[model samples]
Target: MSVLDCGCGPGTITQGIAQIVAPGKVIGCDLEPGMVERAAALAEGANLDNLSFQVGNILDLPFEDNTFDAVLSCAVTEHLGEPVKAMSELGRVVKRGGVVGITRTDWAAHMIAPSCGAVNRFFELFESGFNLQGGTMNGGRNLPSMLGEAGLNVVDVLIALSGAYTPEPGNAMVNGWAEWIENLPLFDRVIEEGLTTRDELDAMCAEMREWGAQPGTIAATGGCRVVARKD
Candidate 1:
């Protein structure tokens, strides 16, 4: 069956979907032209004839009504102000009885053990800045309701906790997260909004590294996947 991967970043998951639905068409769409180019290049490199990529928006998808047999999106709704409207658009592109799956992060359920002051301060600033930018921090937990509101029949909801523990010697988990989070656009947003200074942000990341170095450090976050049918 045909499939659409909305907001497919880099097409890593989209490539896998194309493989799963070989001989059937799969279109990966994203808002960024650069991301579309990269996804298309990846598909070309893999020599997958059934896969294609395009630039599109979640709130205003470019496809015609009932264009796809199924749709899958991940980590995109949380950044959207009108998540229900976006889901409605996803539904609009699916054939009757087609499925739509979405995965999102519930930031309220995120937990970092050995919760140091720096980490806490960082989250405070980051969350505030994120909300100020019109993004939802707890979008995952609301997906089921959002889907239902979008005129889809909720089929399943899977909520899970994913995390990594910091191992000794290299301080893998903590160091990696510290570096990764520092590089995220959210970090820059926090600074740009004057919520925190660059020095403080750097210090926070450093402290996170140190905190992870301590014994029994674990960083976990909650995520949810909701599946619905366009009946």
Candidate 2:
């Protein structure tokens, strides 16, 4: 099967799919040339002869109509101002009877244990900061509607929660959040936008770490994946 992975950053997932669809071709597309280069390098390192990478936009995919047997995108829609348009483009690239799959993180559904005013304030600031950056916090919950609107038949929906209960540095969710908080530019942006002060953000980060250490504490975020068929 010929497959296209839209918004495939570094081609991690695209490489995995290439392995699964051995002897079949897979193209990983991203908007950033650097990302394309990184993906291409990884594919070459993996010796994946059937895999390739290209720089392209989701809103206007570079592929011809009905060029792919399947299309897949992950963790991309929330950043898009016109998600439906991108979805339609995904649908357009798939051959009839082919499939399209998308997954998104629902930022609004994220929860931290031992709720308190400080924790609430932290999330409020996070949400506001994301919005100020032109992101949709609730994009995951709207996957089915978006796919349907794009003229695809929704075949399956999967929702899952992921987080860390212990203060394990290797835990992906924990590390991801920590890295985001520690990114100097993002931190500065939040402060510049008046979402919160540096001191308050630091306090919240410390509190979050403390909470992660507590017994039975969990910091979880929801994700949704939708599989659709172009009929």
Q: Estimate each model's TM-score.
A: 0.91, 0.89
lDDT of all the models against the reference? 0.85, 0.82
Prediction 1 global C-alpha lDDT: 0.85
Off by over 4 Å in 2: 114-122, 167-172, 184-186
Per-candidate Cα RMSD to the true structure, in Å, reads: 2.0, 2.3
Any residue pairs clashing in model 1, and if so which? none
> Tens-digit lDDT track for model 1 on 123-224?
577577668778866668888999999999999999988777755533475576577567888778777777778888788788887787787777777889
Each candidate's number of clashing pairs is 0, 0
Q: Report the C-alpha lDDT of model 2 over 168-201, residue by residue, as the tens digit.
A: 4333454355456767465678899776787887
Stretches of candidate 1 exceeding 4 Å from the true structure = 169-177, 214-216
The clash tally of candidate 1 reads 0
